[model samples]
Structures are given as C-alpha cells and as structure tokens.
Target: MSNSDFKGQIVVYSIVGCPFCMRAKQTLRDLELPFLDINLDSYGESVRKEVRERSGRSTVPQIFFNSKHVGGYDDLKALLADKVGLDRLIEEVKNNESPPEAPKVPDSSELKKEKIGDMDFTCELDEHAVLIRDLKMSGIIKDHRKGLTTHKNTFQANQFVDWLVKEKSFDDRATGIVSGQDLLDRGYAAAVKATRDGRFEDNDTLYRLLEHDQNSALNAGLTSECEARPASDLGEDLRKLILSLYNDFLTPDGKSVNYKGIAESSQFKMYTRMTAQLYRVDIKSATREEKIAFFINIYNALVIHGYVAVGAPTNLWQRYKFFNYVSYIIGGQLYSLNDIENGVLRANRKPIGSLSKPFSKSDLRLVVALDQPEPLIHFALVCGAKSCPPIKTYSGKDVMNELKLAAEAFLEGSDGCQVNADKKEVKCSQIFKWYREDFGKNDKDVAVFISNHMGPGEKKTSFLQVISQKDYKVSYMKYNWAINSQ
Candidate 1:
C-alpha cells in the first residue's frame, strides 16, 4: 500500500527499559502527536507474532506513522531530518484520511498495570532485607531503642523516604513512599503502630525491619557501627564484583552494557551493600596504582549505577546536575562522580565550566586526591553514554598498562581520532576538547597526544606524518549523549 493509504494512527512497539523506545516516545511527545505505545514485553508471544507479521521486525521500538512503517529509531531520525516530508506524513495522520487497523493487544498503560499485577513483589523480600540492613549499617535509617513508643527498634517513614531520595536517588518522595510501602507489603519492614491505614507515608510515622532469623540478632539496635573490613580486602572484593557484573551483563567488546540486566542482578544488590563498607575503608594507605585502579573502577561502576537509578541526563544542565549529584560516601567523605574524576583522578582539577577546583585545600577529601593528574583516565572512565570509551575492569598490578591499552583502543576509533590523509587534518572526539588541559595546552599538543596514543597502523603513520609536517587542522566530533544500552 502507498504511504497515504495509511493514516490517523501512530503505533510504537516497544519494551520497558529500552532507551531507543524511550527516545522514540519522547520525540512523539515533543511533536504534540498522540500515539498508542504497545509494550511487547507486556504481551504474549502471539502479540509479538502479530507485530512481526505487520512490521517485519523482532527488535524493540518498531514504529508506524499511520499504517506505514517508519522502521526504528535511526530511521525515524532520518525521516525527521526531512522536515517537508515529515510534515506531509504528519498532516495525513492529522487529517485522518483513513483510520488504520488497531492492534488487538492492550495499550501500554493497561499493560503496565497488568504487568505489575503479575509481578510477585514478595520474591524481593530477601533483597529488601539486604537493602534495609545496609541502610541501617550506614546510619541512614537510625534504629533506636525507644522511638515514638517503647518499641525495641524503629525508624520513621520520612527518614526512609529521605534515604531513598538523597542516597538511593529515587526521583521523588512519592516514589520513595511507594517503595517503602512495597517493603512493608513484601514483609521486609512492618508498621510499628499500624499508622496511616497501612500505607507508607512521607511523614514521621514509625516502622521497623521485620525480624528474620537471619538478621534478628543484628536488629537489636546495639550494633549501629558498620562492620569493618580492611581497605585492601574490600578493594579486591570490589574488583571481583565489577568483573562478575561485566562478565554477566556486558558484551566482550564492551560496546554494549546490559544496564537493565545489571540493575536486576543479585550482584548489583551486593554492590549496593558494598558502598556502605566504603565509609570506613582506609584509602589513605593504598599505593598509587591501587588508588588509580580503585577510583577508575568506582567511577565506571558508579556511572552505570547512576544511569540505572536516576536515568541518563538529557541536557547540559541535567548533565552538570547528574555528575555533581550522584555520589558515594567513601572514607567518611562524600565523593560525587565529578569528585572522583576531577578531585581523585585528575588531582583536584577544576571540573568543566568550574572556576574552582572540586576540593578546597582545607577539605578533608583533598587527602585522597592524587598528587599529579593521570590524563589517561579520560579514556578509562565510561560515562554510560554512546560516545564514551568501552567498559573494562582494571587491576592495581596492571592498571597503568590497562590505561594505555584503553587509550589506544579509543584513539584507534573514528569517534576518538580519525586522520584524513588527503586533507592533512585530524578529527577527534569532543573528549579531547572538553578535557583539553589534560591532553595538552593547545590544539597541536592535543593532536600530538592523540597521535602518540594511537596503536601502530597506517592511521598512526598518517597522523604522525601530519604532525611532523605541522600542516593539519584539528576539529572535534559532536558528542552523542544517548544511553549506551545492549
């Protein structure tokens, strides 16, 4: 059928946690066009079969402008680039020339409720126990001997919501309240007084961890201190944990990170617990290589954690907020993503667009800052974005070599560095432009650094020749901020 034969309907077949699907829907929203979103994940195989039969695609985010297939995200983007053509298609849809056939499956909202109803949230009882245990250990939820009434140990609902927002980075108090109710409903926590008709509140209503044989003794409120582990031991465990996560969810090439799977894994729950132990870890005694490896791993893992928990930042202001807001409490000091990259990794350098260094001379966290900057970390740290470098776990024993290899891999790619032999010009990733000071003082210096880091190849030969002749222009490639999903 011709494109005009289909009109007056827009359908998007998608799945939960798919970034491209979210982008497609967001684009529709921005255009002020109403579309029926169909979540394949919420439907049966028959529905998927129907979608495949109609759209001829098995992947998520199959879109149809009217009954005419618009393909996937990239296709939609290309169509959008042709404004006149897109406007014509939109006008046809608006005119309702011929109403297209509606899918037999329920829309996303109905399917969302159905899916939630199908979930056995009680299965997460043990996981929620781990979460509460760590929250108490971290002193976020103050378990007390005598609170509200003469109950043994209790925490307030407001305190729980605060932890969810400030520490866990839940979007708002409402979500935190809902999660709190889920904890209660799942039997991980119980109402101390059955207040508020059994609904979790954002007020000072009291609750207590449900006594389990596993942690009953630890709930006595006497041991409020975190269980101490040697910094070296914790660091090793952290490294292993990262490797396990990468092995299970990250692709071998590191191009795709299964963030949705990572978020749901038992390993991630362990990671959440381990962050509590970071409060007392002795970072000061670690060797330089140990510190580098530790912070690099932390930075990479935290980026994934932030995206899974808070979502990928969409704009420049949101990016600044994200880097500054998502943080960890290590060695009794709060270290933001920016702090780890700039303060610890970059030797307390000023962050992008910042007039001052991340840490002041008098700041306690300054003690953890490197004496000199390591420029190669820019390649090692993955920012959970498409344009960022590949994810890799590092060991302290071989971190320097690992960093070198990461830099080499990055520069070898067109996104990182591309040599146009005919034009005598070098095009580099915006990473070099953003952290230019780290690479060098000027364009020539940055070009030389890129050339040096590149692995031995014809591209390297061409770049080196260009540098030798001092006849090359350096330009930066536009950065893509899309989430790097599997």
Candidate 2:
C-alpha cells in the first residue's frame, strides 16, 4: 500500500540454464529489490511436480510479487507494464505479505547425490566428448603426444590430462601419463566440447588446470622453465581452438548450435577460471604494463570469441550492433569487463597499449587510453564499441566493484545519449528502455531522469526545462558491435 511498507520483499522461482530465468533475475536487479531465488533446475522431480501443481506451470521463471503468482516472463512483463508492479510487490512483502508458496525443492547437495549416476551420461559424455572430437573434427590437434604446455606447472599439466581422460576416456594416450603435446590436444578438445555444448563448467575446468599448473610450477621453484614455455607452445593451438569453438558455439549458420545458451552457462565458469589464472600470475616477474597487456589480449580475445560465437557481424564499423547484447551479459552477471580491467589489469597512470602487444588488435587498446580516471574505466568499457576497447571479462574477485561501477557509469554516461525534449520524447539508451526498473521510481522516473540528462549546460533545472525544450527528442542511435580491428 505504501512505498515504505515494501522496503525489501521479492521472490523468484527460476531454473538454471533458462534464459527467461536470467532475464527475470536481471529485471529484479534493475529494480533494486532484494529477492530470494529458488533454482528449480537443481530441484528433484517430486519438488518440480509440487511446484507445477501449485503454480500450474511446468516451465520456469515463476515469480512471486509479495505473495502472489506473478506468472512467467510474459506475465512479469505485464506487471511491469504499469512499472509499479515491482514497487507494489516490495511494499506488499514489507507488509508481511506471502505469495502462494510454491513447493520447495531440496538443496543442491541432496540433488547432486541423487542425480549423480542418474544423469544422462549421453548428454554429459556428448558434452565432454565433443571437446576432443571437435579438435580432431576441426583438425587442430596435430600430435597425440608431446601435448601442449604453457608452463611447468605439473599439477595443472596433470589436471589437463585428467580432464581429457575423464571426459573422453581415451586410453591410447591415457597411459604413461602422456606428454605436454598429448595434454594439449586433450585441452583443446575439452574447450571445443565446452563451446559446442555451451557448458561453462568444462571451460572453467580447463582454466583451472592452467591456473593450477601455473601455481604448481611456481611452488616447485620452476619459474624459469615454466615462464619460458613459449607462447608458441600454447598460443597458436589455443587461438585456433578458441576460434573454432567460438565459431561452433556462436555462429548461427555454421553449426546451428545454441550460442546464447552455451554463453550463459559457460561464461560464469570462464570468468572464474580466467580470474584465477590472472591473479596467479607472478606480478613481480612481470611489470604492471605487462599484466595489463596480458589482460588486453584476453579481453580482446573474448570479445572476438563472443562475437564469433553469437554469429554477429565482425567488421570494425558495426560496433554499435552488439552493444545491448554485450552490455546485458557484462552488466547482468556477477562478473564484468571492468573487473578484469581495474581489478586484475591494474595499469593505472599508463595507457593500456604502453606495453607489448601479444595479439594483432593492438590498436584497440587506444579506446581504453582516454584521459578518464581509472574509476571511470568501467564506464568506458561499457561504452566500448568494436572501435573501442574490448569488454574485459570479469572474475569473482572484482564482481561487486564491477557491478557498482557499471551501474553508476551507465547512468551518468547516458546523460549525453540521445533525448528529445519537445514531444516529451526520449530515446534513451536501451538499458533504460529495457530495464526501466533499474532507474525510475517506476518506469516514469526513468523518463524524468532521461529528460534531466537531456538538458543543456551544467545548471540546476526544473522538469519544465526537460519537457518544454524544442530540441528534446530521444534519438534511436544504432549501437556499434563490430569486432575491434587493429
């Protein structure tokens, strides 16, 4: 009934691997409402049946505002039509409201135990097997022996081999503990499988192997040999593997794979793995600029990887095309581009390209070279187009900071974006357009805010200035999304 009455109350019933669920979560976050999430995918059949009986929907994204059935995605959107639905729901919850209780699912541990052997091995095996198969299928692996090794981290090297054996159960190279070449082949295979299935877990495991190996090498006092393991040892093969995987997963016409699904599932794991690897780097061994350069390579690589995977156009001029999609992934998740840039790539006081260039896209680093403060780098990345810097992939360590910076920068930078005053028209950024809950008191607040941003000069102005100005019109600007070209 009152705003104060609904300070923090929201509940979302969702399923993992479901895009709708992710969308719903993003919606709630944009609204700034604290809500609990019930992941049905992790639940048992009995619980799912119970939920179905109560909600009368077998599909996921069953949301409750206060204690009422808010239905699925469409239903949620309907509630959002008035824009006050989220606010009202929060109020209702604060008033001690209870939505009709959906059946509760068991915890993850219980589910994991129950589903361990029952899992569709075909799916699991297919997901895993495909990694190796794709490498062979793509003809990327030249040698079954010698396996690739970036460093002398034997633990990671062993893990890489183990992952291959576990996934493929390939016995030929499984004996004698295999060489770096053999492990390299398996690693590439695993990566390919991950891309094909859109399974981040697999990719995460691979990254973990790299991190573990790096650590093992360091702990063994084998830094020289490990560090000298030549980029050629893994770079060329890795590049090819990543390229192929990206194409298979994201490209629509190539393989008809579900790029979006795979991206969502695997991105979280990828972020985690990458974070570990970056953090594990011997910063003392490498200069600050060198670290930033490494991150730049990773950032650009991921952008290219994501773009290819999504089957989006890759020309430099088409940067705006993928802004919304890129922003959604970066901003909606626990990890983001800014996390990598500021948290791990900490090359402040120096430009991004002041160091060496590992990748061909050396020119792209200039976009991040703007005079804006280090704190503003997140905003710069958010605005980064194909012509701009690649969106840095984030890790768990920097998630909170990344989210905060992204929200603030996006809001502030949006002030300079397209807005029309006269017709009470405002074509603000799609972020405001889509996740209106994130900005306004409801949706109306977003319009008012955009109107203020549209005002000229740096003076305190009234709502009248926003509404009455002749030039005030929201222009629908095309988002640039082309791959960064050097």
Candidate 3:
C-alpha cells in the first residue's frame, strides 16, 4: 500500500541527537506514517518551556497525537507494541480528536483464562500448555492420557512427524523408523516433547536438539518410496493455492497483503503441509532456475505462513514461532529459513548471523554455498518488507523468465528502484546494497545489473536511456522495513 495511508498529524517536540525524541518520531515513521515535527530547537526555549509545562517533563521530545500527550519514545513504542494502539493514535488525529481515556491496565491476577478444547488456560506458563498439546499429538504419550486428545489421524500428529527431523536433532535419537506407523512408536518425538516441556531444561543437549545436527535423522515422515512423491504430489496444489491467496487477498495495484483477510483465511494451514512436502524435493538435480524458483515460492509461503500462524509482528519480534525458528527437512538435511536463504539458496557463504532485528525485517546472514547461487533470486524472495518485491508463485519451466518479470515489476512499481535522472543518479532499494555481493562486487557492477533488469515498456526505455551513456551513479534508497500488509 502507499505509505501515505498511515500519515497523520501526530506532533513531535525534539532537538537533534535527543535519542528519545528521535526514537519517538522514528517509531511512528517505521509504521509508514507521517507526523508533525515540532522541532524544539527552531522555537528554542519557548517551545522547550511549552513542552515541559504541557507534558510535565523537561525532555525535548514530548510527543503528542491530536494534542494528547504520548510520553517519550519508550512509552510510544510500548503503546505500539499492541497493533491496535497506533490505529487509535492515527484515528484520533484524523478526526481532529483527542485520544480517549485508556482502559485501566489489568492486574496480573485479572488475566482472563481462555478455553482451549476442554481446558481453561492462560498465557502464563503457555509453554506448558503447548507442550501438553504437543505431547498427545506427537504420539509421545500413545497411552492417550496426556491432557489434550491423542489421535494418530489428527492434524498435529501429522505435522509433528512431518516436521520433526527438520526441526530437531533426529540422528542422536534415531530409532531406524523413518515413516509410517512405526515412526509414531519411536521415542524421538518424546525426547523432543520432553525437551520443550522443560524436562530437560538444565541439560545442554536440549539446546543442541534444536541448534545442532544428527547424522542418522529420520526421513522427516518420508519413506524410501514416498520421498519422490511430495514434489509431484503437492506442487500444483500449492501453486494454485498460493496464487489464489495473492489474487484474492493481496491488493491488485499495490500488492499489499490483506492482513485482516489473511487472519481469517484457511489457506495458511496448507502452507505448513506444503512447505514440509516441498522441502523433500531433489533440488540438487533440478535446474538452477527451478531451484531458485522453488526457494522463492518456499520463502514467500513460509513468510505468509508466519504472519498467519503467529499474527502480525506487532512490535518487531514475534510472540510465537516464526519462519527462521521453524525448520524444513530437505533431502535428509535440516534447513531453517536462515539455512535456506544464505546457505542453500544464495551464493554467499557467510553464516546467517543474527535474529536481533527485533522490529526490522532486514536479515542478512551467511551460509555455505549449497548450490550455484542465482543472483536473480533476490528479486523473487519476499521477506515481508514494504521495500521488497511482491510475492508471486514462481514456476520451474519459466523461472528464469518469471524472475525477470518480478524484477521488472518491482523496478516499475513504486517500491522498486527510484530514479533521480536529473543528477545522473538512480536510487535503488537497500536490497541492492545489502546483497551487493550478489549483484556485483562494487557500485559500478550494481549499476549494470539494474540497467539490465530494468522494467518493460516505456519504463524500461526511459531507465535505460538515462543510464546508457554516463554510467549513472547508484545510491541505495533507505529501505522500508514496515510490514507489507493492509
């Protein structure tokens, strides 16, 4: 969506390098919003005195929304931690109104219990609740008394078995059974369940279970005969499903994901299954474009699945499991999102570094080059960022063509590389700069890459004409890390 949709007349009182003031404004700005700037410096002591008396604080950046005090940066961020908070602030400003009185913060004892299945539970000690559900569903407690209902045919049972080898260390607890009913009898699921349930809390292997490797891991619900089945089995269904999601829920012209609709759609559950199945495909033998296309689809599906499964990233970090924490068992190997992107998909061999971008979508970790990394994959992988390319269900047959199309679309679209032909320069997305190694070793190479991938029709003609002569300078635009959603 055009970011202007979030613009509002929220005011900021501040001076340069006053971190609280900067952060206060930035928090609003990060949501693709606009705010009124009341620079304390320009008005000097008069504005500073006004802010002190008005906000009851001497700080430079005493922020406001429609004249309602919003405290400083931390308070603003805390309010924004709840997704509805910003909307309230924006709405008040839009209507020329003041913020309504906030509901009283509930006491710890006032936490309401939620009914799940037949039990009353609160988020307090929620890990135990998840564990109880997992225990029965993973077939870890086949005796069927582990709180939640145990059914071999239930959804979580299938999901647990399907994703286990990919998510946890399986080789260490290998029981020789790879799939079928025998996999249910194996104790590996129990080990995983126990670990997550805190039975192994002090044991360091628990960490290793998630972060380390095992050699003789189970086939992750794949049997010798069924390994080849998933590639052909679910490919078409997933493609059609993903495309429908994009066509139905995503905005046509803006390509913004319909967040409310996605929160209600049933298609996301299929992504869990499809991702599991796709990971089993034999990418080693697939054409490079096919592999790239495969990962693109995989990444996009995984990202959408993440938002749907856990809700929107309200602040920055997810409250529940996300794509990077979730794993895929691919060809008997475990690959997290980090593993897939940097290690397997991209040519870069740097280890995937940090998960520290609590509110930012910019993650660039490195990995061992699993295959010949196709640079064009950058144009296709969507990381749920406003600055990133639109999600398209890519194809193996026309993956190369599809990659070009996506890149072209991005360049032509508002989110794509912006040009300042007046100064003999073009401003591109930070993706180009972040993964410059993928595009080229330096700026000159990057310029050539952009020129080559210019959009089609008049846009392409115009862009190329501008850059054809004097090696138009490439400046990376400030990337927008806001959620690319409605």
Candidate 4:
C-alpha cells in the first residue's frame, strides 16, 4: 500500500490504566487500521506531563488521526460514527496505485538477499505484503511499514532477529509461517505461532493469506485434542473447606485475606486439620495429576494458615520467621514455604537462599518425581504475597480447568501481559521469570506454552498474531512483594 493510499497512522497517547485509551485503540482495530498506542505510563509521570502540555489536556487518551488532534475516544467515535464515510476513506487508501519513488522493498515476483542478524538470507514479499519466503528464517514479515520518526515507532532491522533469537527466547532453528488471516487478525505474534505451524512457497501474497483457505498449510499441526476436566474426589473435602475460608474471609478481588477473621473463626483449626488429613493419605496412592493438584492446594492452605496462626501481619514477607519456621507435614513429609515450593513442587530440591534448578540433586530431593515441574505451578501456588494468584480452592476434579482459568485470568488481568504492538514487545508477569525453566529453557518455549493457554479474545488474538508474524521482545514486569490484600 502506498503512503497516499494510507489514511495515515492512528496514534493513541494514553496512560496505562486508562480505559478510554483502550477503547480508542479497540475502535481503531474495528476499523482495520494499524495504530501506534503510546503508553505514557511506561515512561512515568514526567513524560505524561509532557504529553499533557503538548496535547493541551491534563487527561488522556489523546488521539491523532493523520497527525491531527481528534480529541479523545469521544471525538474518534464521532468521526467514524459515519460508516459510509469511513469505508470510502479506507477503500481509497487501500486502492492507491502510486508506489514509492525508490522501492526499498523487493518486487512481488523477484527474490532478494536481506541481511538479518549474522546471516544473509534470500527473502521476498508479494505486492500485498505477504512474505513469499525467507529461505533461511522461520517467521518473517514482522512489519510492512514504519511510523514517522517523530513518533519513534520504528524498530531497528538488526535488533529484529536478535530480539527473537536471544531475548524472545526462540530456538534459532525453529521454522514456521504466519497464515494470512492470522497475520491480519493477531498481528506479529499470532503470525509467529502460525508460522511455527505454517508453510510458505511462491505466489503466496499477504492478501492471499487474508483470504479464507481451510486447505492452507498454515493450519497444519495447529490442531490438538481438547482436554476435559478429570473426575476425582481426591481433594474434594479440602476444596469445600477452602471454599468456606474464601467465602468468609477472602474478598472478591483476592488481594486481601482477612487473617484476623480467619484467626477468630472457630473452624480455622478445623480446616487446618482437614489439610493434615488430606496429606496423610499416601502420596503414592494418588495419580500424579492428583498429586499435582493436591500438593498445590496443601501448599496454599499452609501458607494461609501460617499468617492466621500468628495474626495476619500486613508486612508479612518482612518476617523471616513466617516462611522459614512455618512447616507442615504432607504425605508424611515435612515442608516449609521455601521447602515445599522449590524443593518439592518445583523438584528443585534446594533451599530458597541457594539457587536451584528443576530435577537438580539436593539433600531435600524427594525420591519420587510424581508431580514433575510445571510452569503453571507458579500461578497456582500462593506465596503469601499480593502478586500471587488469587486464593482458589482446587479439587482434583477441576484442577485442570481451574489451572487453565487461573492462567487466563492472570495473563489477561491488570498489568498481566502488556503487549506493545508498536515496539513488537511484550511485558509479562514476573512468574515467568522466577520459574522460566519450568515453562522452557528459552523465550521461544515460553511463548509456545503461552500461545496455547491464551484465551480467545480480540486483544489476545491480536497480540499473538503479531508474535507469530515477526521477531518480538519479551520482558518481565516488576514483581509486587506486598501482601496481596483487599
């Protein structure tokens, strides 16, 4: 598409938590136009103040359609409120036949060498921005155009492969193709996933990918059997008791657990006894999956009890006594917060102070490797902190569904997984960092695992689409260590 045909960029400058900003971007997507969403929160207050001065408004989302101020969400709605006018404009932009004076991109029918990172590979793109083939790279066509330099939306070509291979943590040898529809719907990430499962040859234009083609090789190896929740009463009673605790003391948001109420409850000790009883059942008797669910439940229950037993302290993590000394006997084995988490659940078999890896040898190592290390365990296990997954009652029957929902909720939750479409980067929760190995040894593995669990939504679909189409960066959001309370 030529610049004249393009309606110009939709620039959204807004704060991180601003709902209006989110709505504004969503509206732009609904119109099928690519946008650069500038989150001022990433740069802090000073930058936000600068934006306030430039936009002549104290609040956001300040939106610009073709570099002209269009007020905020309300103003954009007014302009696009006319369906015919907007459609005509988009059609004109898409049909523009004028090409650039000097073609920086190759012709649709010719092959050319593009230097990406350390390798010089033959790559080509069709007239509609669909990548024909890279010959060497796996996922290609991360971007079709860049925003104005004043907008600072352009990424370096050299950093593309480096970020994908080194930081995004993909195996360099991995191969895949972004389907046309996936490239359009999901953006770069979804394209990467599709590419991981896609194939490209000659005559595949970017527009062709956008067309409906069930026969497209892009769908290959993308299908999997849907997992059903397993039925088992292995931890049913404990779940009921945990539910009571959650209903009575835990607020809906799960940020706060009323330790005082828990301590004062006549049945608090009753629930604790129930935990002890559950763990008394021989661990070997339960299936490995049951063990995984039960272990997570028991771990969480003990953590809650630890606080109530000593009066829930607001400044919980500051006290070494809370985590170090607190212990519980589960399945005839003793465990503390650090012990059960790293040594048992993770199979790392080492104390907190000393670094440990999954399956590593240590004195605390359990002989049986039943519940092997799972990345989702990080989301399930509550470490008596504010940022931990919300307190939930998990039974063997619903453990599968429970964990899936927890992950989805955590990821889609506030500041959970922030995707910077402009920069082609994603900021994920710190849980991925602390237990990165559990997900995979590298970024690519983590991305693959996440792509599987991310729920069906416009935002997530768009995020993954971008991921699939090109090289992207991944970083961890800062951890919140405060006690998670209401």
Please give the lDDT score at residue 437 for candidate 3.
77
lDDT of 3 by residue, 64-117 (tens): 776678776667878877778877777766655333432112233432242111
Could you estimate the TM-score for every candidate?
0.54, 0.28, 0.49, 0.48
Cα lDDT for residue 184, candidate 2: 34
CA displacement after TM-score superposition, residue 171 of candidate 3 (Å): 26
Tens-digit lDDT string for candidate 4 (296-391): 876676666676665444554645556655665443234566666776667654444455543444332365344566567777777665566655
lDDT of 2 by residue, 1-486 (tens): 334546444667764233455667777666666667876534555665665556655445677665477877667767777757665665667767454453333555546342211221111122223343333343222222224643221223344455456654657444514433433333321222123222333211332222223211111111111112222212222222333333334332121334454455554234322222222232223333333333443444444444434445455434333422331111101112333443334332322323442112332233333222233233324332422321222223343343343333244333324333445554545444433433455545665655443323222233345545554444444554433222
Quote model 1's TM-score: 0.54
Q: What is the alpha-carbon lDDT of model 1 when measured against the actual structure?
A: 0.69
Better of 3 and 4 by TM-score: 3
Give the Cα lDDT of each candidate. Answer: 0.69, 0.39, 0.51, 0.51
Q: Candidate 2: what lDDT?
A: 0.39
Tell me which of candidates 1 and 4 scores higher on lDDT.
Answer: 1
* Model 1 agreement with the true structure over 1-486: per-residue lDDT tens digits: 333444567788875434556677777777777777886646655676687667654445788766678877768879989999898878767677434474444544444333411322111123455666666665644545554445545778888888889988899999999999877654355666553356887887767654411121111112113444445455545544654565456543334567678778876765665555564457877888888988887777677677667767878899998899887656545678899999998999999899999998677678788999999999988887777775556667878976886787677666688877788888999999998999899999999888778867677888888777766789899998886566
Per-candidate clash tally: 0, 38, 6, 36
Per-residue lDDT value at 470 in model 1: 60
**Steric clash count of candidate 3:** 6
Runs in model 3 lying further than 4 Å from the true structure: 1-227, 230-236, 250-267, 270-280, 314-323, 351-370, 456-458, 468-472
